[model samples]
Target: MLRIAGILLAGTGAAHFAAPQVFDPISKAAFPDDTRQWTYRNGAIEVALGLALTTKKTRLLGLAGTAGYAGWLASRVRANRGASQ
Candidate 1:
């Protein structure tokens, strides 16, 4: 289960680089013309976290990181709604 989730996370991260335009809207919401750089940075983080998730020794740490990442995402949603969390 962890491996599958890791692969999906990594794959989406790779896609951020491969088909970045698809993610441009999300990036653009936060950045202006320089969105790709941020996208790449986020992609790299996702890839690293995903890789960590795939390794048994790092799985717990990865879970923690992922949870934090998720919190970041949730913040985005809150920001979009102009709501506090």
Candidate 2:
């Protein structure tokens, strides 16, 4: 399960970086009016973290990265909602 999640994270991260326009719709739906731009750097970081997580020694790092990313996304959603109101 961890491996699958890691692969997915890496794949989605790559997609976001390689094709921002494609990712933008998904991001907009999830984040509403939050205007943060998803860039190649974000994708690279995710991929690196995912790779690290694949190794037993680096699983914690991967989890941390995932958690941080989730927190960021959540914050964006909240901020967008707050701004609209």
Candidate 3:
């Protein structure tokens, strides 16, 4: 059960990170002229962390990465909304 949870969490995190590139057309249409390198970096890091989560030895790292990513994502969402208004 724990392992399954870990896999699910890791996969979701990875998807969040890759969202921009995976959905490039949508992103470009929504946010024209926004070409940030950090998005790709985030995706790469998330993929690495997700792979790490699959191993017992790196579970802690994976959890930490997920928590950090979630916090960062929340902050970004809040900041974007604040700016739009």
Clashing pairs in 1: none
Best by lDDT: 1
Which candidate ranks first by TM-score, i.e. highest? Answer: 1
Query: What TM-score fits each model?
Result: 0.80, 0.70, 0.57
Arrange candidates by lDDT, descending: 1, 2, 3
Instruction: Please give the TM-score that candidate 2 achieves against the real structure.
Output: 0.70
lDDT of 1 by residue, 1-83 (tens): 99889988988888999999888767655445467887887788889889889989999999999999878866665565522
- In angstroms, how far off is 35's CA in candidate 2? 5.3
Tell me the spans in candidate 1 whose CA falls farther than 4 Å from its real position.
30-33, 80-85
Cα RMSDs, all models: 3.8, 3.2, 4.8
Model 3 off-target regions past 4 Å? Answer: 1-21, 24-36, 82-85
Regarding lDDT, does 2 or 3 come out ahead?
2
Lowest summed lDDT over 10 consecutive residues: which window, candidate 2?
Answer: 29-38
Q: Model 2, which residues run further than 4 Å from truth?
A: 29-37, 82-85
Residue-by-residue lDDT tens digits, candidate 3, 5-83: 6666557546756566664443333223353454455556666777767788988887888789778766665555534
TM-score of 1: 0.80
Q: Could you tell which candidate, 2 or 3, scores higher by TM-score?
A: 2
lDDT of 2 by residue, 14-53 (tens): 8876777776655664454443364555667778877876
